[model samples]
Target: MGHPNDDTDKHLRGSLTKQNKKLSRLKCSVHNYDWGIVGNNSQVARLFALNSGSDIDPYKPYAELWIGTHESGPSFVDHGNGRLESLSLKTWISDNPNLVLGERLLRSGAVLSAEKALSIQAHPDKDLAMVLHNSQSSVYRDDNHKPEMALALTEFEALLGFISVKELMDVLCSVPEIVELIGSGNAKQFLLVNEQYRDKNAKAVLQSIFSQLVLSSRNKIGAMISNIKSRLLPEMQKRKLTDKEQLVLRLESQCPADAGVIAAFLLSYVKLNHGEALYLGGNEPHAYICGEYIECMANSDNVVRAGLTSKHRDIQTLLSMLKYTQGFPEILRGVSLNPYTTRYLPPLDEFEIDLSILPQATSVVFPSVPGPSLFLFIKGKGAITAGISENDNVEEGEVLFVPAHTEIRITAESTELHLYRAGVNSRFFTIP
Candidate 1:
């Protein structure tokens, strides 16, 4: 038999240990950015309304819905006591890293639901992130490279990466203002260099054009926009506009005077249908033009913005950190693990995503995960009958945390159940 002192010691140790539940519900944090779609039209706002079970204000601009342990918008654990505990996700995970993330995912953190156009920016690599974080902690919060993937929740539009050298050359030749920015001599030289280096070093050739355009003067940019409007506006009204031309018109509405208006022509414009995905590595320059998507990044919030926003612009840093390359954008559809589930796998070891769409009154069993998992219910109602959490009710926009190695069985109530799971894949823990 244990002594009274021994029993007391055990109790104290239990209290000190993490109070996290095995399959606890999560109370996520939300960000109201200026770029967010106004009123209850915001998807983030709708999700928040479902979680709170209240009437949406319809006027608040809910820009982002964040889930995970990142300090910027850390989610809170729901203890099911009719009250949410004050403990943050990051601190809670730190208290029991192995239980939550296991060994692989302990290094990474957080997921996001972005509503409107995110800033035109790129993340620094790991080493550069560290230097930036250390030097300017306020601006660069964490020392982690953000290799993010976006699974389109709705039809999403973004300016991703660089356009082809030949295409860029055509724009340069066709637009008098673009020709003026780099001068006739340099433009001709760039074309010649592109022809010579197209097969060998395309990225370098693309970089030369991008650098000149990005570094152009405000007056030059103004002239370029004016010229574009004068030349293209009449044609835009007469015929079916191309995607790139449409983007120019959209940018004209948003920020006509901004240099990004000119810069947009240099980048490839992409639109992802619902359920499709896109992967962006660190140092890639991109700007989300519109629509909603689920964004998962490697636990960092360091964005070096160049333009298309009212926020602080870090043009020099952005120019210095970009990975200049041109290619047709690849839209990832994910690997289908089953009829009901598809897994989106990016190159980064930090995170991966699985989307499940269950039919009406159907039961689906998720394969046991080797690491901690985050599940977000996007559509319909469901009851999760999983290890340690029996008959737990999950509805649209509800978030859940499933501990490592826990068996998961979700059943649709009366309608289809749609959810996405993010976790560290088994590859990270396996010794190859």
Candidate 2:
């Protein structure tokens, strides 16, 4: 009514707004705060082309995948406004489930590809961890501990569950010098009961015997260990201990008598290569990540960690949650579908990932009708060109969310594509 050209201008403005909303705009950078891990305290995960460091550099455990939540390392995605802001992935998924998990959103299986073995420890059972964290004033983030599944992308090793009272006795008795630590009583019971002697009794015996044995070619404790062990481990020597066993010996040398390593061995031994994963939850005590994979889980920022680096050592808390029984963690693998699509399954419900590896130039359809989804380009390069011609490329670690009701199409240009898709699905039901 105001002017004849007003309707055309308004239509043009609406077109521009739709174009902007559907345009592909995403970026990534190596997590700098996640440097408290790796070889030293100063190691920073080198970032790619994107924003620069945005936090304190002093924090030691400095390696992180900046995707899901955690404001410190959230994936800075651009919203409708040209201005870029951090998006909370957890909330994003919860708001839109159809395009993410479809009908299987709740039946989620987050996958992990470790570049190196992580730590040998476990998160508490949900309630226990909650109570522990709730009771403590210093702990940060949510009290609901993470129950993760570690699937090895390569030859992976982990200490899953506890060693039995009997198995522990056998491993300790394997060395003659350690025999006295047991001394008539149940070695396990005595160490737990006798406070004054606990440190000096068993833990010390292990340290003196195992750590010293591998200290060097010539050492006091090492000499004693060598002398005592040759007899006790005659059969072990005859069979030649495994490489993992050798690695264990080396770790023992570094932290002799550490209950951590002893606890590590009590769990099961696992090894995997490409296309393999270890499904571990919070209760499973394993530490080591030696592969590269699409890692996804509930938006968690709490890690009840142990022996792997010289960082926070919650010895009592870690030990208190451990189950001293023999067990193993389940492993998940990927199924190749035409080299453009791969399905993965982990033993968890917090997250799931589907790798769509497209060759040359082609289009693929993902019928995501769940909630919201977090997608990334971890290999090759490609883009999801929504119906309006908006295109966002898939490059190493570049992520975006496929909101519910968005049936998108993606195509590669001038190269093969490797797309990493992951997100959280919260509809979980416990077996009664």
Span of 10 residues, lowest total lDDT, candidate 2: 42-51
The top-ranked prediction according to TM-score is 1
Which digits, one per residue and each the tens of the lDDT, describe model 1 over residues 372-424? Answer: 88888878998897775668778897888777778888988857888988888
Query: Which is the leading candidate under lDDT?
Result: 1
Shift of residue 164 alpha carbon in model 1, Å: 1.5
Per-residue lDDT of candidate 2, residues 118-167 (tens digit): 56556666677677767874763556656654433335555566544344
Q: Which ten residues in a row have the lowest lDDT in candidate 1?
A: 103-112
Model 1 regions lying over 4 Å from their true place: 1-21, 102-116, 189-194, 197-205
Output the TM-score of candidate 1. Answer: 0.89
lDDT for each of the candidates? 0.75, 0.49
Model 1 residue-pair collision total: 1
